[model samples]
Target: MRLPLGLAAYRALSWRAAQPAQEPSAPRPEGALLWLHATSAERLAALADLGQRLCAQRQGVNLLLTVNAAVAPTEPAALHTASGRVGPVLALTSDHPGLIRDFLNHWRPDICLWTGGDLMPNLICMAAEQGTEMILADVNAASLPRRRGGWLSDVTGPCLMRFDAILTDTAETATHLRRLGLPGRRIAAMGRLSTGASPPPCPDTALNAATQLLAARPLWLAALLDHDEIAPVLAAHRDALRFQHRLLLVAVPADADDTANLIATARDNGLRSADWHGGDPIGEETQILICDDSGDLGLWYRMAPLTFIGGSLRPTARGNTPYEATALGSALLYGPHVADHAAAYARLAEAGAARCVRDTASLAAAVIQLSAPDHAAAMALAGWETVTESAALTDHLIEMIQDRLDQREAAAHARA
Candidate 1:
């Protein structure tokens, strides 16, 4: 029987099924392998952030990210891969048993988590049979694609049963899952699986060295700055420098490709600056320190007490999350374009952790005001508290994973 979609869908499935399967040569690490799946790029980004949180909670844990080929993860996951923590990404093809089994055998995943609505019945059921604890999160049945003959429920029912827990984004999703034979007790109406992430680890030696070198200097970070943002950030620095000649700007460009241009721009602004990637020092004469390396955000987040999260001052791009800056003890100054993380930013604003700036003038004024030790410390404390509150959700997810893993261990012990 031809599965419900159209000829195009059938051909796509056939092509995927025909692809050869192979056991990856990469050695599986000692700990559990978290298999995370997401259908869209946005969900992939959320999963990447979640994976980062999970790894932070458990030492030496490896994550196996699986996303649809069309929505390959780039930014944050690439960042983790570059840091040598996350394992090589596994691009899933078809729901073919052979392909899924080959991947499971090679990676030996201990747990599996799928986000969004799409369901691959064979793969999910096989994973459950192999004793992998499976979870379906952020489920919304309305978003799930329907087949021409209403065959979706038929195929999804048994596979839904295999999940250890089903976290629904709405009561409707929970109702649908319950109708499909998932027990009411195993399903809960949890919101979206997205959560703020912890700051990436920074080397202590580097952090200490930078802290020591910049001692007593009024320093602030222009974090994840873009090329267009160079002018405003530099202008803000210049404006702030008038009052405090000892002020230093730690400018981390969003794109490393912009470093040379950023350096030129800084010089054009009549500011003495050093490029950290090029082994330049943060001298007393240096007005801006260009952090060309992206990986050292953790270090900079810790070094600076006040940060202007870039990519927001301009209208073209939304800003990066302030959670990391706040988590690492930095009071935030962001532009009005923080729609991407509006909820997280709103909580920060409510807690007096972050202040929104409309232009270079406002940014400069906010920076100068936050540069004061007493005021900055209080904002940083508020930001930290906000981050801690967000951790309640993370802690809940962690507890679920731990309980499932512990249950498996106990079962094995009883069998022995």
Candidate 2:
């Protein structure tokens, strides 16, 4: 007869646990452990920088990063440089259990973070045995097959039961974990980490210039545009023109070539356009300003009262970040394909702070309707309120970690 499924799963878990731990050559001081499951080296580097900032904020805490070895050498190298400045970094070969074990043994971190993908059973078991706090942040597991198969059982279920806490990106995920047997008290619905990322300090000159250009005009932002979004965006711009002649649309291209196409499309639609590539001033007649610079989305979001997050209009794009616009006090609009930032956008929409458009015509109609001065101002206010309301999640996570640390110290003292 075949073994019962639960029994078989339990046996597998036990067998994996019985294997000898990977041993490293040298012992290092215990510190806060951070495991970066980054989708790319660039993202890993960004997380490492944030880790450093967190450590600087709180003294007596050391951060050690374990990154995927499969990440491109250049990206890992960038993380290496950043980690060196803050703490130590260990890059692990993907699927290499022994190397991962050895690194875990050597670092002996107080807390283990899993960010990019599903938590592996072996890793979760190891962290549990060591009494380390485990958390998964900014996670996206929307692929329906993965959800149905329940691949996270071994790691997420038992490990979640063992760990001090589990902070997830969405209420739906928290509900799923509860159904899997994790205690409700132990689960907190924290939004994406990218929401908490610090915005760059705004330059007074740029802020003044942007404010002056906007100068009482009904301004809106169309950010991170994919190739197919250009024509529809142009249509939306024209629709907005029916209500206001001084309407301004700022186009932030996802790629360099897209910028040219966007400008050409705007010209064809009967609007004068200018590119910010050469740092030219926005002339009085310029209706669309193509902003081609990287990392300036924060500034642009702040400058506009209402913003449409691009990449959602095209099915190929996974959607850009809406939290940036929300955080910067701009009301948001997006398309249907925002699988990546779904939770964030959904929350804002439910709060009446955002709207979702199905296609070009719907997008144009929404733009024209929202361009009303009072309506735009109310939506902007609602968006800011939603952002501030969610701010408690970060504080709640921090308090939980501190409580766990205290409990660990008390247990250690009792043992002595």
The candidate that achieves the highest TM-score relative to the unseen native structure: 2
lDDT of 2 by residue, 49-139 (tens): 4565556656656666666555545354445555666555555544334544665676677776655443454565666566567766555
Maximum-lDDT candidate: 1
Candidate 1 weakest lDDT stretch, 10 residues: 74-83
Evaluated against the true structure, the overall lDDT of model 1 is: 0.77
**The 10-residue segment with the lowest total lDDT in model 2:** 139-148
Q: Would you estimate the TM-scores of all the predictions?
A: 0.61, 0.62
State the lDDT of candidate 1 residue by residue for 1-416, as single tens digits: 33334433533564565656555556777766778887754456566667776777766567878775554543433334323534455666566666777777887788888887777766777788787889888788775656676534455665677888888877877886677566999998876654455687999899788878888788999999888888988998999999889999999989999998888988898999887868876678999988888799999989899998888877877678788889899998999886566666777899899999989899989988888899999999998876765344446666787676667668768999
What are the runs in model 2 whose C-alpha is more than 4 Å off? 1-13, 16-53, 56-107, 112-197, 276-284, 399-416
Task: Give candidate 2's error at residue 194 in angstroms.
Answer: 9.1
